[model samples]
Target: MNVLVLMLTVLNCLSKASERTFPRIVPSQLQFLEYTNLTVTCEGFFNDMIQWRVLRKDEKRNRRTSCNKNTDAFGACHIEALYPSDSGEYWCESDDKRRSERVQVTVTVTDVILESPVRPVTVGDHVTLRCIKRKKLKPSTKFDFYKDGVHVNTSSTGEMILHNISLSDQGLYKCNVSEKGFTKENLLQVKAVLLELPDRPVLEGENVTLFCRDKMAASNYTTFFYKDDEMIGNSSSGKLTLNKVFKTDEGVYKCQTSEDRESEEQWLAVRGGNSFSTSDVSGVTHFNMFYLSGLIALPVLLFVLVFIYKKYKGPPVTNEEDEAKYTALTKRDTSLYHELKPPNSTC
Candidate 1:
């Protein structure tokens, strides 16, 4: 009788202490970009007996019988194309009644999609842009490529190729397709490749020259250098020079040919004048130089002002009455000269 009672007690304790060994979905992101293929795997459990469920609103949808295919022994759910309606909490529940933690996923819908390579498009690369419906992959339909909203090319094969890509070919592209008497458009961005660069570890006060070349040789076109999207200089020789580099000169730099070909922005880092390079100072852009310089100077300026005030005003005033008056002056005026005025005097 005692053995039976102890066995029951131990079994109850074990049951109470046991938790779901696998409690999460792999690639556990709550939000996913639309049209992306997502493979959400329920990790930790080694059972093929696991079942996946997606809870949308108040309804429970089965993954095994739905649009997902079981990928492996752990019952990973794979969705080919995710749509907005697919947004919900997903989880895996084992046959033994162990339930994994639910993962919320949201899918967004868009009118068009630009299908391009993941890497930057370079010269000599035959880049192709295919516009497609975000939700479904349907039959090959006629499509047109538009640059800056103007029609450039039309193809019945649903693909437009930029052959022997050059700098002049870079622009904001959009693909348009007519379906069911309605036109759908999507945006595409093509970036130019870096052809040449100066030696690394650019030091302050040193001069450096950079050259930008297009994949194809097009004569009579001038190249313009840009720092943080602002045009710095133009050269017909495809060469741009940085004279007497300052800390302020470091920034994301790019070049565009007169043909309107823009190169990919690259970081130009300038270290202190004493050293050529430092790991901590690398990759910092000069875009915020003005703001950073003001921030650094403000505290030093305040310290100098305080020192001059203490030296000229005789012994330092420390009374509560004087402190209150000082605080009041500071609150009254935002400018340094106004704040430094005597408590009872007006400037």
Candidate 2:
């Protein structure tokens, strides 16, 4: 019974390890215009037991509901014709009560909404913001863009392309259409530097290379890396390669260029070195659960087998004749010892 309990405990741990804590959003953006379609997919090997979760804005309490009759085989929840009421926090949740990180979704009902990524864009990235009108507008309509209420650029295609975004470009942005009013302001964030690393969960003892990239800078700049606010290493190639990383290496990391331009701190999570397949669901895998379960069960099974063998195999049994012979030998040995004893010897 104890062995069975141990095995069960191991299985439970494996199940927890395989759980993914986030869902994937189609189109990869958080904000959308009203009446648009959005698909939230639960990605991972064990996503079959996962479902979509949303907290609508107008609701006084949290509510859980299924997709709008448009679920696919991939565990995706399709929300068609999203209205402003649909704007709220969204995430994925498993039946075991594990939840993914919540993402705030905003659905705007304005006649014009600026099309931009809700997520913060890295520095030196080329981003384009489009002025999307609810009603069909002329292709040649002139559009004006503003950064913090200051006119920056004008475009006839209704799209403003930002070349090599820098820290100075981070501000509130809104666009104006010909004769139409300005769209709602959206914040455009830019980082001075970006540390590029693997998208998957990093396992312990694996070699990881972090690349400090600054697309707008010259190639001759030096890059420095820090872990938990402590300087660890630096390189001229803007790359810091850590060989045989351990769990101790897991921490918040950041990089800076020679010009003191720094990037946003990112956390490095080092998992166990055990071999397991990971899924896109927040860097957790599913198939490795069985493999780890077998590892835990093998030793317990061996121990149980040895215990049973000892329990069934009792001590050696002796017949009556053999017991009498052993007794006679014992008496003879005692008589021989008495005969060999010295006269002066005391008991």
Candidate 3:
């Protein structure tokens, strides 16, 4: 029985590692105009339970029904009338929660513009930025580039390339193109890469170590570790150790080499042993509930106060002397009219 169990474990690991991959979304542009239709087709074997998911920020939006109608033949889905809230990373997943590679979509309720990729890119990777012109792409000569409102480069092509992007290359990049004697500018952002973190969960009071790796791993460079954007530790051995982890230590952790090429930031969850529960209801955290309730109720409370004031106190008295005169005149007129009126007559 032990031999059979060992064989099964090995087989499971191999099966997981050799799992078949899926093709990306065709006509793959990340950004789109609001109310536009997006048709995406999966290019791989599809299971009956296969569905699509959207990942925005740190949260994932799961679909209730199958995105594809005829999965046994072709796997495709159409999104009609996209909104700004629809912008996120989209991917296909099986019933068992096995997910395929993600494709990002950003729907904007603005003019046609260029957009950057929604996916995180690593250092030494080629990043491509695209210019979107409504439903289709258009060609234009004399393209000007700007970084944070500072002019950088000019190209005859609409697309701009950042070959082997580094830390300094990360910023808000804008492209200006003259179309029909009118110049339109669109913005895109680039970010630095973060380092890989520990996969295993660190229990409270336990020690944790972080490592930084880059493309030039062979070269020797000092490593710096940051927690919640604050520098916490640094080491020459390319590794930093945090002794006695606590719930306070749980935050976004990242590292960077001396070359300034940073790694991807990852959340470090310190669970067990008096740690706070991370389980949330429908992806809504306690903090989010409080924040949303406060935001929604604040304006309503202010509106109620304003309505009560207007109903009871009426409008503001901009000219106090004039208001007083008006009040006095109204009272005097009412008294004189009452005095001049005839008394109640009894028949």
Candidate 4:
């Protein structure tokens, strides 16, 4: 019986001690996006009463608003429509105001006007959008970026980076001032680009080579070869060499290269390895015929020589005596007695 009475007395003392202890609470990192919500709470203090208080660390102003130290032993501190100046250290203290610890409260103030990410960004390019404030604020606070009403990224710094920008990136971008409740918006413009080839190109075969050469001497500029609207080959130096070509190689080929814009294309009308030769056919054909006639005439030339010799030599001219004998027999020596007798004598 005496042991039971002692145990009951000890239990009552322990309960009273538990009720008097108050829980501790602290606020972590704070942010300001034009408007900020700050909540500070106390926990674990069952019996001890908790009171919410706000104090401007720079100006030293104070407030007590936690349940007015009523039924709730733990409490919270809240400030509405927080401003840059409203930012300070706050605390949840015991109702007696004797015990306290600091709760960090942050409020962000954004620049009234922001200038960032100048317009006309090409698709697949990198871009940077910056926000500049009219007035300077505390430097320790970080900045956050948003796109098309969505959170994109944050910088523990004042600048945010966007890489490999795309068409989807085209939207209103705003910067949130994490420390001072400031926000600024800017418009984005993204352009779409296409790959293209040159207009007209003429290629002569064998003795010539075609290139997707640019009128300019730009380096690292590439030329893409196209046939019937589809790309088939790519070159850095722009030259496309065709060696030992065939009829299948004949067709239209175009090349596009890079400049500030695209370079003048070297469009090539590839001839079927022999088209160049065919173009001047009339003259070549005439010369070939002349050469063939000369070659055929070589063997017939000997027969022509033999005919000329037979006509010119032997029996064609007779000496005067034979001529006179024929004349005497046929005409009976009409010229004179001397002509008749002149088988022996020629005059």
Candidate 5:
């Protein structure tokens, strides 16, 4: 009984831990032009309890605030006109102290800006940086790319593409148009290792493969795979394949290289094969609840059926003595009826 309680407690914790809360940004970019609108919304199961909080660039503390005018009915906060003063870190915070990932936003009034991904890119990813100018540029315009204030490459299309980026590629990047001017420097972060898996939920009983690759293209290095902080396996090829994955196989997974470089941990969700619509981890929890309910209800159902049968159809005569007792009772009733019968008086 104690073991069962422990199992239930652990499963409940897993179920609750799987639900994620995060802030969603419209336009999905960290940098914005002055006077442009920005929208932020908290997304999760407890969105109603979440509120927008920001650490302004000039301020040392974070404070809760609403949109410039009013928050919409859907809980989205809108900044109608962004200014350089609005540049800071923004995130969602719940009343109970739960916080989401913070996003750094920059608002600039420059004539040109560099367009890049807001999030860090994995090593070996092909990344493209575009130089956007407030005014249109000529088709034959020449753009110069710089990393950390050093000229790296030049492009004619007003964009620079870095093929198979490595750690050395991560630095402050800027672009200069031939006639326009230079844009503000933007930071490019490249991770050393990346663990690859399916972005969508995997179906139970399906085979899943996870690959861990070194951004530097190292040939011989042992890779270690972990699930929920527990080591599961290792390989020289930096790949791990799980055959016929079950709900129990679902958890947070990450990989590490021989040099101790680790990738970010990601959740692996497994859903019932028959239930494609239920995509979250709660689906597995529901299945577990149903299974447990069946286990607890089966015995009671059998007991109730036996009780109803005995209450209406009577009990079975399991022994000869019981059968004899039933026969004697019937015979005695018949004899008594005969004794109580009066002699035939009708003529």
Candidate 6:
């Protein structure tokens, strides 16, 4: 019996590894603007139990789910709500009685643009359009990107991203998002930038990083940035970066190489300021909030205390005034004293 159990364990391990070996099925094209229908198929020879999951690029872990068994040999499972976060790899387990293999499937929702023109955009321009996904993908299904009707790029983690593009990237742009196997599309106009920062831009108060990139690409074409027709200090590394920037750094900026080839002038504004006021109005307002109740209740409390004292201890009498009144009464009684005098003294 022990030997038989050991054999079963080995067989189970082998089957598990095999069931995990295959990739999940994905569609070549998806139809969006309709109800979601994301059907993911796995290679199977196993029992009815199928494992499924969704994941995000930023997440280090995956969420798990149990799948409903397909009644046919297709071994497919369907999920609904194909939102932006539902874009991820899906795996299914297929156990063939004695051996098993896993299938890994990639799910894609159709993200095609519904509102973009069929022309390539020029440089140094911006475009705006609305994106709509009809498929009922989960809130996690991200939009896929494309150019010229071909898969040129992707944004699986976010809904939108700026291209910071050049003339070389001129093509039609669209979006693809899917859910449950249903697809969505969003049309967009792609434009090239003739004058701008090519890489990530960092704006600083005292120190500014400046850049000027040409719309055309050539390894030998030197890229240079000029402010008021003056070149920056120097560059140990070829990147245009100014550390410890100042307000004086703000000015008209442009890029040029070979003196004749130049981009349009662009303005960069850098406002420099530092403050240490104990009396900023907004700050004071927040700081003095604690004193509001006490300040308001002070007069009312004084009035109440006076009323309470009058109720409990009667009215107050001044000792000096009372003494003066008693002295006057004694003076008036002095005549009686004189009448009763026994001829002793000058009454």
Candidate 1 wrong stretches, greater than 4 Å: 1-112, 117-124, 131-160, 166-184, 188-195, 198-201, 205-207, 214-236, 256-264, 273-347
Model 6 worst lDDT window (10 residues): 51-60
Model 3 TM-score, all chains together: 0.41
Model 3, range 16-69, lDDT digits (tens) per residue? 321223334435556677877776654332322234332223124454334444
Residue 242's lDDT within candidate 5 is 99
Q: How would you encode candidate 1's per-residue C-alpha lDDT over 1-347 as one tens digit per residue?
A: 34344444433322332122233443333444576766666432322223543222323443432324433234556777777767666665555444444445556465555554433567666887765564555665687778766788988876888898765666666566675222333323345535354535456889988888865446677888887679888888888888899978865677887666677655564656775133322223232455578889999999999999988989756699798998899876667776587998955
Off by over 4 Å in 5: 1-25, 40-77, 92-100, 136-142, 177-181, 201-211, 215-220, 225-253, 268-347
Model 4, position 317, has a per-residue lDDT of: 55
Candidate 3: give the clashing pairs: 193-262, 193-263, 194-263, 194-264, 195-263, 195-264
Q: Please, what are the lDDT tens digits per residue for candidate 5 over residues 1-347? A: 44455455444434343233335678776778788888877643232223434322233345544333443233556788888878777765545454555667778887667888766788778999987776544454678999999999988777889998888898999888767678777888778888887645667889999999877656899999998789999999999999999988876688999987887666576766763333344555566688889999999999999889889986666799888999999999999888888798442
Q: After superposition, how far is residue 110 of candidate 6 from its true place, in Å?
A: 20
How do the residues 1-347 of candidate 2 rate in per-residue lDDT, one tens digit apiece? 44344444434434543323345667666667888899876554222323434322233346654443532222566777888777767765545454555556677876677877655678778999988776665454688999999999998878999998778899989888767678777778787677875655567889999989876678799999998789999999999999999978865678999887887655565667763433332233233465568889999999999999988997656798789999999999999999999999997
Each candidate's TM vs. the true structure?
A: 0.35, 0.53, 0.41, 0.25, 0.54, 0.30
Give Cα-based local distance difference scores for all models.
0.58, 0.70, 0.59, 0.49, 0.71, 0.45
Stretches of candidate 4 off by over 4 Å are 1-112, 194-347
Q: All predictions: root-mean-square deviation over Cα?
A: 29.5, 15.5, 25.3, 41.3, 13.7, 25.3
- Candidate 2 accuracy as lDDT: 0.70
Question: CA shift at 125, candidate 4, in angstroms?
Answer: 1.6
CA error at residue 42 for candidate 3, angstroms: 22
* 139 Cα displacement, candidate 2 (Å): 6.0
Total clashing pairs in model 3: 6
Which of the two candidates, 2 or 3, achieves a greater TM-score against the reference?
2
